[model samples]
Target: MREPLLRIEGLRTVFRIPGGEFAAVDGVDLEVPRGRTLGVVGESGCGKSVLSLSVMRLVPPPGRVAAGHVWLEGRDLLALPMEQMRQVRGSRVAMIFQEPMTSLNPVHSVGAQIVEAMRAHDPGASAAALKERAIEALRRVRIPAPERRFEEYPHQLSGGMRQRVMIAMALACSPRLLIADEPTTALDVTVQAQILDLLRELQAETGMSIILITHDLGVVAEMADEVAVMYAGRVVERAAARALFEDPQHPYTLGLLGSVPRLDEERERLLAIEGVVPPPFALPKGCRFHPRCPFAIEACRMAPPALEEIAPGHLAACIRAPVEQSVAA
Candidate 1:
């Protein structure tokens, strides 16, 4: 197997609140191998967005990375100086945020934004070359009339178009890794499928790895080569997408799978998780999910279970859940 394009080890992001510290991301370990897509799935406030921000060193002022390493192409990004980190951010790694309407500047022309992103990483490039490249990028994302749309402001474009522009800017420099945090959240179903298909096509052409953060299991099923299920602030299960869907090892994973709405099944009501995700500041002791976990036991209440390998590549962080039985049955 190829060396991982990005590897996060024991990543912990903490925020200072009124009285104490809160962990938005706690001890997360993940890897995105070159040319593979790793989908991160969880409900809201499960630390999915925080994990992405921490990896990029873009955590907000009151919050910061407390420990662990973010290794991109073997270099420890956490140790890099601010100036160097800025260079690496867009030149090597790029991100497409959740809301393009909010993320894109209202005043700037979409093309101008893309050009600025290009110039930020490559200051020596000619203005004409940058413009040409920007237009080409717009075309690559399948935006109609790249020349006309280039001069339009964010408000002038539709939601789907604005998202395409965001994607275009992120891929403008052909970064080695792209972190997409719910890139299709605000768009309609048809547009969402188009955006996802575009991402897959772009990945195939560039061989760039992607970390797709989303709460939609259907999206994960469609695009993910591997899946990581997170709850409260930690990953509860990690496995290849097929293995995860076929045989989820953790109770949370099973609950997530069970909650995915099925079109074929005739049901009186939709299945859903029992309770809400615990607040970051008030995470439960031991297993964060213990309070809501149907399979919680005394051991789960006493101490947090470390992520353990149950099969060749699958991992789960639940002490009471029987991994062997799940895989066998």
Candidate 2:
């Protein structure tokens, strides 16, 4: 296996609350090899978004990275000074937020925003040069009439076009790693497919790694080289995309896959994971997922299980992982 372009170890992000603090992202460990995409799949509030923000060191106020290291090309991002980390954020690792409308500046022209993103890393570049590069970036993402669209505000473009602009700004600096947090949310199915295709094509062209944070398993099936199944704030399972889809190990992962409708497999109706994601402050004992796990047993209530290898390169936090036996019982 090749060395990963980005590696996260024991990452924990916590937010302040009334009593104390609760971890929004708890002990997540993942990697993204060069030119590959790592899909992070989980339901809303499962800490997937928080984990991405932690990597960019952009966790909001009242929320902070309390533990672990975010290593990017051998340097520990968590240990870098604020100014140094700022330099690394866009130039080396950029993010495309979930909602482009909210993420993009409402008042600024799309072209100007991309220019600002580029200027941050290349301050010495001339305004004209930046404008030309910004337009080129928009064109690269397959946005037609890029020159005209550059001057338009976020509200002026359609949802799909706005999303493309977000992609353009993120890729403006040509970062090595692109963290896309639900990049296709709210778009129609056709537009969603286009965005995913654009991402794959761009990755092929740039050889940049992507950390795709999404709740859609269908998207994962289409794009991820590897998949991480998150539950409550931890990575409950991690495996190669093929292995994960073919043979899921953890109960939460199984529940998630079972919930997605499959054309190949006939089912009377889609399955649903029972109960809600336990609130961070009110997490359960032992396995965080025990409350919703149909196969959970007494052992699951004792203490939190550690992420352990169930097969070569496949890891799951459940002790009964390779959970087929539990399924049989």
Candidate 3:
């Protein structure tokens, strides 16, 4: 078997608050094979974004990676010094943030930003070659009038265009892994489809692994080969995309799927998972999701269930046994 491009084991990220240490991402493990997309899905504040930030070592001040290892192509990223990590960030693993408007520098032209990214990774390359590569990158992302848009600043471009520029910058060095955190959140449905298609095409062309962080199950259905379902700072379930969708083992995962609107089903009322995600500081004992889970039993209140493999390559933390299997079979 080919080695995975990125592997995260027992990853835990914590923030120091006035009260005490609060973990945002707790004991999460994930693996991404080369050229495959792994979708991390959960509601807001479920530590999806925090996990991405932790992977890039960009966790904000007061927040620190408390434990675990982040290995990229066999190199331990967390062990690398700041200078070395900086080199690895754009060259080996690039990230596309949720909002391009906030992510892109307002002062610099998009073209100049791409050129800078190119030069940063390959300082020995000539200016002419960098310019050509920048233009090619834009074109590869299907940014029309690449030459013209190259000179335009972030504000001058549409949301979609700015996103394209962000992707171009990320792919400037053909990084081994791309971390896209809600990359389509700010765009309209049409533009969202376009951007996702472009990303899929680019991934195919370059064979770069992608860690897509989003709450949108629709996007996950379309893009991911594997899926990780997170809840209250922990991964409750994980499996191949089709297997997860067809047989979600965790109650939280079931609730998430139930919430997604289906075209074939017409109902007067929409199904909603009741209650907001609990804050990290006030996490409940046992299963963090038990308070909201309809299937929560007495056992769910006393001890947190360890993540266990229920089937081949399918793991879930829920104590219940394959609830979706009889329904599907």
lDDT (tens digit, per residue) of candidate 3 on 159-266:
998899999999888899999999999999999999999999999999999999999999999999999999989999999999999877898988888888888788
Per-residue lDDT tens digits for candidate 1, residues 1-329, read 77788999999999999999999999999999899999999999999999999989999979999999999988999999999999888779999988999999898899999999999988999999999999999999999999999999999999899999999999988899999999998889999999999999999999999999999999999999999999988999999999998878898888887777798787776667798888998888999888888777677888989999877799989886574553455
Q: Give the Cα error of residue 325 in candidate 1, in Å.
A: 4.4
Model 3 ranges off by over 4 Å: 324-329
Q: What's model 3's lDDT at 270? A: 66
Give the clashing residue pairs of candidate 1, or none. none
Clashing pairs in 2: 286-303
- What TM-score fits each model? 0.96, 0.97, 0.96
| Model 2: per-residue Cα lDDT over 216-291, one tens digit each | 9999989999999999899999999999988888988888888888888999978898899999999999999998
Return model 2's CA RMSD, one decimal: 1.3
